[model samples]
Target chain A: MSKYYSKEVMDRFMSPKYFGEMKDADAVGLVGNPRCGDEMEVYIKVREGKVESASFRTLGCAAAIATSDVVCEMITGKSLEEAVSITEKEMVDKLKDLPHVKVHCASLALEGVKEAVKKYEGK
Target chain B: MKKIYLDHAATTPVKESVIEEMQPFFSERFGNPSSVHRFGQEAVMAIDKARKKVAHFLGAKEREVGFTSSATEANNLSVLGAAGGGHVVTSSIEHSAVLNPCKMSSGSVTQVPVSSEGVLRVEDVLKEIRSDTTLVSVMYVNNEIGTVQPIAEIGKAIGEINKKRKKKILFHTDAVQAANYLSCDVSELSVDLLTLSGHKIYGPKGVGALYIREGVTVSPVMYGASHERGLHPGTENVPAIVGMGKAVEEIDFRKGEEVKRLRDKVIDEITSSISGVTLNGSREKRIPNNVNLAFEGVEGESLLISLDSEGIAVSTGSACASHSLSPSHVLLAIGLSDRMAHGSLRISLGNETTEEEVDHLISKLPPIIKRLREISGR
Candidate 1:
């Protein structure tokens, strides 16, 4: 296990529960850039005003992948408003904490989710 | 779960023979070489013998070899000591050990660009030399891509230029990586100074050597007693010095060919099996032990971590893994796009690398790349 990541982060990275593209995703939000070494696309399937399913695909380090996984898990089965309101701190807490250098990963995950939600509401 | 080390460019394990040779120096023969007594003389004689051995390995004279704490120091002495604030000419991809000193020097520096394959052209270096330029330092092999620089050709070109110039330009090469696979004969290469590291060559860390050709003047980087001819003034690391000498003597080019076979096998298999994998650096001019590859639509740190979990060690040029959060400068210098640079991995083999280890790596790599590409939604 890498000292750069928490055990929870490593676990999520190795076996991401919500990894892959959602074929039926109602809204998709992409954030970060490959050039910056972390790019994430968040997929959300909504039913009646609640997130029916959520998934993500990330190109990044272990922390970024884990953060994306945790963000998807956090928003699933939640109202669209609640999902968009998820804070970076809450996601970081879910991953047990990130290396100082990797804290930006949490921000990227949050941005991805917000972008997806905005796309859903606009439509 | 056997752990495999493929980061030879970072450092190598000290050979047992080198350890055995260093054993006596740490305790029984621990006297200071600078002291005047039987004990000191014993240490002195051992140092002399080690110096001669290292000098012989480099095809240089005993008096030309001066031991430093590490190759970084040796490089500092070469760039800062020789140039002494005069203009310096160097390449874009030199190790920071050489690059940083050149920047810190009072003299203006001209960093010549390299070919996209990471090979420095002799004329590019020759064209950068100014009337005030006193030193030109280039590495014999790039640590990242393992591209072999044309040190001999560049050295000869500089030598010809020196014949016409009033003040001759001194040439230097950091042979730390090339020492294992290439000829380091100073005269044959026509370099006025050279740098080498012990730890990179299966010897203990904390000992490196700088070769200064006769009549070439270099000032001391530090001040202390008249140790190392006052060029590097400090108490010598006797044991590491002895180990470095033993390691240098044990270098065999025949073993390098076997390593080349294994390296080729890994490259051929990975590139053939994986569709988006691209080899970095010049295929023909690269060293035997290096294999740098870039995988499309995948982050290198993720691949490195996945391999690490499988008991295999590797390195990446990804910004996520770097301290400065930027992709490898060497990769960028070679004209790789930022995305490509961030997706690159470096696997360096060593003397102990075997066919079994290579097979294990080959079997594990394709699946990992597939998984990462899938995760990235490729």
Candidate 2:
């Protein structure tokens, strides 16, 4: 195991949850920088004002993938407004702790979710 | 749990015989080689023997080899010590050991680009050579993709140029990755200097050797009591030096051929059986032990972790750069998109690597790629 990666990060990376695409998703959001080598897409299935389900597709390092999965799990079952408010810190906190270099992954995840919400609202 | 290590390019486990040979130096023969007493003389004898053994292995004179802490140190000395204030030329895909030192040269440095397959063009390097270009450093085998450059040809070109001018141009090859599988004959390569590492060749870490051809002068990078002919000044690391010598002597070229067979099988199987998989470097020009592959829609680090969970060790890129999330500069230089470069994995084979281990990794990797892809929703 790498000294830089936390156990939770490893666990999340090893068996990521909320992975895959939602075919009937109300909206899909993709966010990544080509130089960073990390691209994340968030798909949301919204029913009423609450998120019925959430899933993600990500191409990146361990932290980026884990944070993408974590963001999907965190925002599920929350109201649209509440889901949009999901902080990047929440993703890192859920992962126990992210290395300083991997902090950008959390922001990418947050951006992905917000982009998905925006797509759902027809923005 | 069965453990399968495929990260040989990163570092290798020390061989048992090497450990046995090095045992005495750490304990019973613990004395500084510079000391005048009998105990110190024993240490000195061991160092001399090691130097001679390494020199013999490289077809070099015993006095040509200088011991250093690591391959990085050897590279620093070769680049900075030899041409501290002169223009340097190097390929885009050299290991940091060579690239960093060249970048730090007091004079301007020219980075020649490689082909899409990661092989450096000798013509490109020759074209970049200017009158003031003091040194040309290139890696015999690339650390990231295992592409083998034409070192001997480049060395010949430099030699021809040196003969034409009053001021001779030096050629240095970072052969750290090649020491295990390729020839290091300084004469055959026609290089003025060569760098090698111990850990990469089943010897202990923190010990390496640099071959400076007879009459070639490289300024001292550090100041201390005269040691390593004053090129590198410090107490000799007797144990590591002895282990490195033994490791070099123990290499069996036939075993390297076997490793090539397994490496090709793995590469053929993965590239043929898996979807969206591409080989990174030139198939015929690559080192015998390297298999660098890219899986579409899969994050490299996630794939590495997934493989680790299955007791299979691999790397997304160079082990030295694994801590960074950025894509490898080598991969980028070879014209891979950021996505393809990020999704690449380097699986290096060693002499001891068995067919079963290769088969195990072959059987295991496709599913991991599948899982990551499925999760990725790509």
Candidate 3:
């Protein structure tokens, strides 16, 4: 176990939730860095201006995958406004804390959610 | 659930025999070798026997083997000692131990690049050789991708130059990764200095040897005691040296052929069956234990973590650079795009690895890649 990582990170990495894509999704969010070798795609199903279901797919480190799971759990069943407003801080705070090096994962997760919501709104 | 370790190129577990050999040195034979008493003389004898074992393994004169804390120290000493105020030449794919020392040398440094497959061209190295170049250091086998450099061919080229030059240029090789799997006879490799680490070959850590050809002069890196014949000055690590000696003495080059079979099976199964998979390095010229692959659409680090969770231990790159999120230099040098480089995995087999362990890895890896790619939706 790396001293750099927290127990929460390891737990989340070990059994990430809400992983994989959703069928008949209303919107899809994709974000990645070719250089960093991290790519994340988030799928959403919206009902009555609220997030009905959420799921994500990602190719990255443990932190990136964990962040994706965390973001999906945070936004599902929430109003689109609330889901889009979810900050990187709010997601990380929910994870207890992310490592300093893995903070980018939170941002990427946020981008994934925001992109999904934006595509759903047709804006 | 049994954990499978496939990271031997990083560091290997100490063998039971090596531990047994090292036992007496730490307890009953605990003596500062500098003392003139019987106890000290006994300690001295142990180190001498260890040195002779290492020397015989490398086909070197017994006196030419000098012990150091690790291969990194040996590399530093060789580059700094021999390249005294003169230019040094090295490769881009060398371990940081060799690369950094050459970088800090008093003389100018030139790094010859390797081919996209991570093979260093002899002609490319020859072109970088300057009249004032005092040393040329290259690794015998690359750590990340396991590309075996043409050391003998490079040595012949350097030898030709040495014969014609007034200041004969010296050649050094960081053979830390090569000692277990390759022919390391210094005369055959034709290197003036070679660095080897004990931990890489199932011996105790913090013990390594630098095989310096007789009559080759390298300035001392440290000052204090006259130990290691003034080249590396420090008190001897008696127990670790004994362990290292035992490790070298027991090494069987033939066993590596079995390792190669298992290594190839993993490579063939993974690359052929898995999507977005590509083998890294020149497969034909690689060391027997090495299998480095890049998975397209999946990040290497994530795959590494997933495999770890599945009771399989491996690496995305060199253990030294694992903490850094940046792509490996060796991968980039081999013409892998930032994406491909970032998605690389290195699985090195050891003597203890079995066909069952490899079959488990192959069965586990495809699903991991599939899941990560599915998550990515790309």
Candidate 4:
């Protein structure tokens, strides 16, 4: 594990449980720009107004990948409103703590979740 | 888990022979060269011997060499010292040591662009020369992409241009990356000033040398007791200097051919086996030890991490690994998109590299890249 990343971050990044595309995802949230070098897509499957499954595809650094994985895990089994309300602070705390410069990675993951939820509500 | 170091361009472990030469200076021979005592005289003789070795390595006179803390300081003494209050011309792909100093210069700086292969065009550099331009600083080899620039051609062209001009435009090359494999003869390259680092060439760190051609006048950047001909003023790092000199003397370019074969094997194996992989820089003009590549749809930091887990040390040019979160400026200047720049990896070989180590890297890379591409859903 790199000293630059917390153990929790490295663990999730190395073996992210919720990484990949969900072809049948009811709604998807895409956040970040490729130009910025961190692009994330969050996929959600909805069941009875709650998240049945969540997955993510991230093209970014270790912190960004870890945050995406944690966010996906956080939204699973949670109601759409609860998932949307999951804060960047909560996500960062779950990963122990990201490097100060990489705190924005949590925010990017949060924005992905919000976008996914917003898409599901609109549909 | 076998550990393999492939980040030699960043630094190399000091050679055992260099350490053996440096051991006495740290204790038994510890004396300030500036002092007038008997011990000081001994230190002076040691320094003179090391200076002579360094001078011989660069094909320069003994007096032309000046010791600095590192190549960065030597570069600063060359740029900030010679081009103060005067316009400067430099390349866009120089290491931060040269680029940052040019930025800090009081004079205006014109950065000439490079080809997509990361090779700087001599004509483009000459086109940027202005009447007020006093210095043209370029690197002998790019640290990131490993592209070797045409230093001799640039120097000769600048020399010809200086013949008809009133104020001679001084030519300088940061040869830190080239010292291990390329010739740095000051006259052959026709450079007025040059920079070299100790750690980059399997020598101890905290020591560097600059070769200032005879008749060149460079002002001191730092103010202190008159040392290094008043160009750089600081207590000499005697042990590191001795090690650096020994390292320079030990350099044998013949060894580079075998390293080049290994580098080519890595490149050929990776590129042929992996799809969507592109090599950066001019392969023919690149240094023997460097292999920089960009993996499509995969983030470089993730690849670096995965490789690190397997005990293989490498580096990336991705923005994620940088303090400023900016992708490598060299890759960008070479016409790579931001996404591609974020996927660049640099693997540098060293004298100790072997076929088994190369095979280990080759065997490990495909799966790691495939896994990253899968995670990114590309």
* All DockQ scores: 0.68, 0.65, 0.57, 0.71
Tens digit per residue, CA lDDT, model 1, A1-123: 676678898899889999999998999999998567898999999999999999999988888899999999999999999998999888888888788888888999999999999999999
Q: Which of candidates 1 and 3 is the stronger one according to DockQ?
A: 1
Worst 10 residues of 4 chain A by lDDT: A1-10
DockQ rank order = 4, 1, 2, 3
Model 1 docking category = medium
Q: Write the per-residue lDDT of candidate 4 for residues B1-378, one digit (tens) a residue.
A: 889999999899999999999999998999999989998888888888999999998999999999999998999988899886699999999888888888899999999999999999999999999999999999999998899999999999999999999999999999998998999999999999999999999999999999999999999989998888987788788889889999999999998999999999999999999999999999999999999999998888888888988899999852223665678889999999999998889999998999999999999999988888888888
Q: Could you list the CA RMSD of all candidates, in the order they appear? A: 2.0, 1.7, 2.5, 1.5
Which TM-score values does chain B get in all models?
0.98, 0.99, 0.98, 0.98
Cα deviation in Å at residue B7, candidate 2? 0.8
List the candidates' TM-scores in order.
0.95, 0.96, 0.92, 0.97
What level of docking quality does candidate 2 show? medium
**Model 3 lDDT tens row, B1-378:** 688999998999999999999998887999989889999999899999999999999899999999999899999998888889698889988898888887778889998999988999999999999878998999999999999999999998999988889989999999999988898999999999999999999999998899999999888888877888886677899999999999999999999989999999999999888977889999988999999998888788778877887788999889998878778989998889998898899999999899999999999988878777776666
Give per-residue lDDT, candidate 3, residue B294.
88
Question: What order do you get sorting by TM-score, best first?
Answer: 4, 2, 1, 3
Between candidates 3 and 4, name the one with more favorable lDDT.
Answer: 4
Candidate 3 residue-wise lDDT, A8-28, digit = tens: 777777677788778889999
Q: Candidate 2 vs candidate 4: which has greater TM-score? A: 4
Best by lDDT: 4
DockQ of structure 1: 0.68
Per-model CA lDDT versus the true structure: 0.90, 0.89, 0.89, 0.91
